[model samples]
Target: MIKESTASAFLFHVDGDGVCRTALVWHPRLEEWLPAGGHIEADEGAAEAAVREVREETGFDAELLPGPSLALPAGFPHTAPVAPWWVVEMDACADNHTREPHRHIDHVFVARVHERGADEGAVHEVRWFTEQEASEAEGLAEDSRLQLKALFAMISDGSLTVAA
Candidate 1:
């Protein structure tokens, strides 16, 4: 199958009411709600591409959390995984964006939004949804819901934490 590679970052933040929410972008071509992400540019790693995509799509600086470390023999070497949150292979229609039938190998990362403008409208068209809300939200991709569920589990199990 013809496949394209891309990277995405899930930006999570705690609202004033202390609710955990994630930022999603409306993908016009796909007509679905997705995280801030896009094609990985040349000379970019998956993690780096993810961060850049999030910034471009959401206008928020996102800091990605590291994934698991590599375990190699004393003399052997391996490049550890960069974006540890999630990685998925999914199918997509060739739309105006790509202009050809293709699939996407998505590299997903968990990140926290650092800076947002005072004027909410200034940010790109984005929506913030709580875990429960995301689960029931329409127009959301199945992968998105599954990832959100996993994220909630990670938080509940103390694997992820929001900084004050």
Candidate 2:
């Protein structure tokens, strides 16, 4: 049996004029707007990775509005039940064999910036998308849209607390 794993995180920021915006990285597979995130490095924590990823993808440094915590949307199916022992291992192994899900269990944070600033020279390209723009993106995940809407609402208000 081989054991391997990956962790990721994303950031939500508000651009100038209080327009809640998020940094969406262009994923090669699921080519669409997605929250800024990536795999957690060997020596980095979830939040740290998310902050670094946001900066690397968007060239804007962000502060984690909240710590490493689970931000499941309402009625998230995670708590349903654990699969059987072998099934869990099989699923993990099959998933590993195929491809590592990039957005799996990403540690999410909230941060507000007056602007997106700039884009890092990395291969990753970013866009400041409003909720409507994000929702309109083809193949946009429902969960991601929900999360972005929550962030937009919080940023729209005067506070960017981790209420999402």
Candidate 3:
């Protein structure tokens, strides 16, 4: 099967009540709640795609919280882009037989929503979910649910910061 590159951002924000919440969009084609993300465009890298997807889909300006970078020698002639939290390959259309079978190499990122854009019109209905709410949410993919659980646990342990 052919493989296409994609980027996904798990965008989170801390509510006024000191609760961490993540945004999810209902994917009509997949019939599941998913993060705001899409294919990586030809002109951009995965990190750039992740941020752009979040803005276009959810009308939120997000800053990616990249994983730790390796220390390079001072004379290294390259600059490394922000690293994704995780990467996985999944079937793009597992149940849809009409389309050709393809796989997605998804770069998963964790980001914080800095602020909502002036134009709050999103492509899909956006819903915020607390940890408990997300755990109990129906139509959520198991992989996504596991990621959310880890994110919430990190936040609770002060390992992840959601402050703007």
Write down the RMSD of all candidates, one decimal each: 2.8, 9.2, 2.5
What TM-score goes with each of the models? 0.83, 0.63, 0.91
The residue-by-residue lDDT of candidate 3 on 127-159, one tens digit each, is 888999999999988899999999899899998
Off by over 4 Å in 1: 69-81, 115-124
Across 27-137, the per-residue lDDT of candidate 1 in tens digits comes to 876778888888877788888898888777887778887755555668766665565566678877776558777898888888887544442432357888888889999
For candidate 2, what is the TM-score?
0.63
Instruction: State the local distance difference test value for candidate 1.
Output: 0.77
Best candidate per lDDT, number? 3
**lDDT (C-alpha, whole model) for all candidates:** 0.77, 0.55, 0.86
Task: Give the candidate number with the greatest TM-score.
Answer: 3
- Model 2, residue 97: C-alpha shift (Å): 9.6
